[model samples]
Target: MESEAGEREPVIIAFCCHYCAFTAADLAGTMRQQYPTNIRIVRLPCTGKVYVNMLLEAFVDGADGVMVAGCEEGSCHFLEGNYRAKKRVNYAKQKIEEVGINPEKLEMYHIGASEGPLFARKAREFTERIRKLMQEENEPENQIQNEK
Candidate 1:
């Protein structure tokens, strides 16, 4: 997982809703489902409460990837929280892309409280994707240095 420049393990920030996403993560642990340990979960009362700045700050502070996990469509405890979160996540993705990072580094997911396996699977997948992206980001530097 270390890059050529001694890059450490990828750090992933996950904003999870209390009602669904958080519960799902808890269930994942209870079920002994395996996922990446690099993810740092931030519990939110509702996904709608997540601001774009919060997500951006995660990247600025060295998170290689970000994830917003909420209740399934039409099932948000706050009625429209998940929908609003989806829109905000999309907006953040675009902004990050403008700054030269791949938009794929940021993602949104909807998970029910009972979907522990799915949650774990997605977490693992996201971590692997970010690891690949980090490696890609370093490849050009390595090539240029090699040419010297």
Candidate 2:
């Protein structure tokens, strides 16, 4: 788990459900929760709103890892938003593999709006995985070309 030395901080992009994960993230902040500083959250009305294109765009934009945060099963704000996100993540995983990116760099998680500790734990866990992946010599290059 080696971080980029000297100056550059690791970059992570999280697409969070506005109803749950996003609010939990906000709560984490208000609670002064200590977690990795690498994560940058992008709020979406629902995980269903997070297109595969957006996930790829994050990788192309230099995110070391990307996570899609949504509500627990059957608890989505839009009824089936998390389900849609789960399906999309699977599709994106396959596409990313085809493009030479390690699919493990992507993750889909469920959180409750009041689960600030859970949110922080997920962030730490995801960040650790990214760190280890970055340190691997045989790491696959999954750099998707940025769209103009």
Candidate 3:
């Protein structure tokens, strides 16, 4: 990942459920919680609405990582929606791994609607994780090993 000036950074995409994670993200902004701006959020009616293809497409479109954020287990407005999303995210992870992509690039998170600071923290943590992963990949030793 890189900035316009080629400075290191990470671009992450977060798919959030309207009933939970999305509201938390909105509240995070109002709460002035400091987080990296590199996380791009896509609000969905339910996390279950996300398809495996969509996750893969985000990667293809240059996202360094992707997150699926939704209601916690047993707390979804739509029964089992979060569970369904978790399953899909896991499946997507396996697909990416099969293609030689790092499975760490995707994650599923459970967030409460009122957890504003938590949302912000997650955004920052994911961005950092991606940044470190990218740094490791770009290291001279890693390049030489990969080229061998």
Candidate 4:
């Protein structure tokens, strides 16, 4: 939808693990790093707590894109939470594609608690990517409507 600035704004949902991703986000804020305001973060004890259904529900609830951010590989506080989160994210990607949404709209990221800059960069990048995807998805329909 268009925001007050008259620019199309996609709703991006970020599922972040408290041990790493969430902390990184907080650090980013403290560092005055800027990311897209369209991103809505949902904090989780661990990325492993993320489920495919939750990802799908985000879309159904009008999220244009979803991101699951977890600890770096082999560094999950729960030992294997990141690994399980990765698997679920991959599965969710496939399912989202089956429903005709761009699979790229959903992604998983491995982040260290110290990577605040990386977190901000990724949030901006992902937001732009989803914005482009949404534009592309609507282009054909807009053209058809114009043609009629």
Question: Each prediction's Cα lDDT score?
Answer: 0.93, 0.88, 0.92, 0.94
What's the CA RMSD for each of the models? Answer: 3.3, 4.9, 1.8, 2.6
RMSD of model 1 against the true structure: 3.3
- Residue lDDT tens for model 4, 54-84: 9999999999999999999999999999999
TM of each candidate vs. truth:
0.90, 0.87, 0.93, 0.92
Cα deviation at 127, candidate 3, in Å, is 0.6
Worst 10 residues of 4 by lDDT: 138-147
Residue 88 in candidate 3, Cα distance off native in Å: 0.8
Clashes of each: 0, 1, 0, 0
Best by lDDT: 4
Q: Which pairs of residues have clashing backbones in candidate 2? A: 101-142
The order by descending lDDT is 4, 1, 3, 2
Which is better, 3 or 4, measured by TM-score? Answer: 3
Better of 2 and 3 by TM-score: 3
Candidate 1 per-residue lDDT over residues 1-148, each given as its tens digit: 5555787799899999999999999999999999988999999999999999999999999899999999999999999999999999999999999987899999999999999999999999999999988777779886575466
Among all windows of 10 consecutive residues in model 1, the one with the lowest summed lDDT is: 139-148
TM-score of 3: 0.93
Q: Output the better candidate (1/4) by TM-score.
A: 4
Candidate 2 regions with alpha-carbon error over 4 angstroms: 1-4, 138-148
